[model samples]
Target: MNIKYILLPLVACSAVALAADPPVEEYVYGMRLDIDKVVAISEPDELYAPCRVVSAQMTYEDSAGQLRTLEYLRLSSVCSDIEGSL
Candidate 1:
């Protein structure tokens, strides 16, 4: 006899379910990144030997069904003898 009461509860329940966290599989899938194919370009310099990326790791996510990649770089400088990530 009261459609509004039924519809309101249904809408509230749907909203709660949608606000919950995603499944473990989906979370892992979105956070997975493949770094096996990443290669750093090396530059040769006479004076400092050029600062270059020694290693790289990428984290990828499927946001709204689109692939997005984030790169983390570990750089090495021959002149200052410094190694760090960026």
Candidate 2:
């Protein structure tokens, strides 16, 4: 049996597996959200879908010492909305 023959197939299989993953949809970009007493920065290029797909919920603490929840649609990829402070 020739080892070379098996090598080609292995490389092709690896490539297919990598492509199977879905790309990121929604991105938090440069904005921050407050959750229920916990604040977390969203990952760069993080994929997410609003109501049409999976919703991203944020829970963190507020200045008032109360837990708060913010539900919003990620309009980074799907929508063309620019958010930033100049």
Candidate 3:
């Protein structure tokens, strides 16, 4: 008949579920990526600051069907119509 006791387990379970994803790894040049299927990817906000460097994440499955997460830096903008290019 205690509310806190019941809620504690629920909160703990939810946190574990949310953290079940694999940790992100920094991408390095010459690193072999055996991506077989892409599950999700972060999209940079190019409109905010076009040429700024931003962090990005990608979740995918490798050749052996193991889920993997990778984090890397990328340009905020990919468009060629910026001031310099214009």
Candidate 4:
């Protein structure tokens, strides 16, 4: 008998639910290196020497307004002399 009352409540409930939902976050994978901060130089083994590297943790917001963080590695390097000795 009263469709308007039922429809109004339904619309209001939908709007509230959408507003209360948490923002979506995006998952990312990759390597980011900063060549400026080379902490040390040591050979982990005979084959590779990952130069100790340090970089600031990356922070940004995704498209859905969610806070995101990309952690940096403590040590990473492209060992050009992989065949050389320590």
For candidate 2, lDDT tens digit of each residue in 1-86? 89879998999999998765333334355656443356543322534533133355445566676545444454443233222321
TM-score of each: 0.26, 0.28, 0.67, 0.31
Pick the winner on TM-score between candidates 2 and 3: 3
Q: Where is model 4 more than 4 Å wrong at Cα?
A: 29-86
lDDT, candidates in the order shown: 0.47, 0.50, 0.82, 0.48
Best-to-worst ranking by TM-score: 3, 4, 2, 1
lDDT of 4: 0.48
Clash totals, every prediction: 0, 10, 0, 0
Tens-digit lDDT track for model 3 on 1-86?
99999999999999998777887899998899999999998957566555667788999999998889999877655543475677
> Which sections of candidate 1 miss by over 4 Å?
23-86
Number of the top-ranking candidate, with TM-score as the measure: 3
Ranking of predictions according to lDDT = 3, 2, 4, 1
Runs in model 2 deviating more than 4 A are 29-86
Q: Is candidate 1 or candidate 3 better by TM-score?
A: 3
Name the lDDT value of residue 57 in candidate 1.
Answer: 32
**Residue 83 in candidate 3 has what lDDT?**
54
Q: Report the lDDT tens digits of candidate 4 across residue range 1-86.
A: 79998899999999999876444323345544223333333322433445545443445544555544444444443443432544
Give per-residue CA lDDT, model 1, range 1-86, as digits (tens): 88998899999999988765333222232555443432333333335557665433333335344333343445554534544332
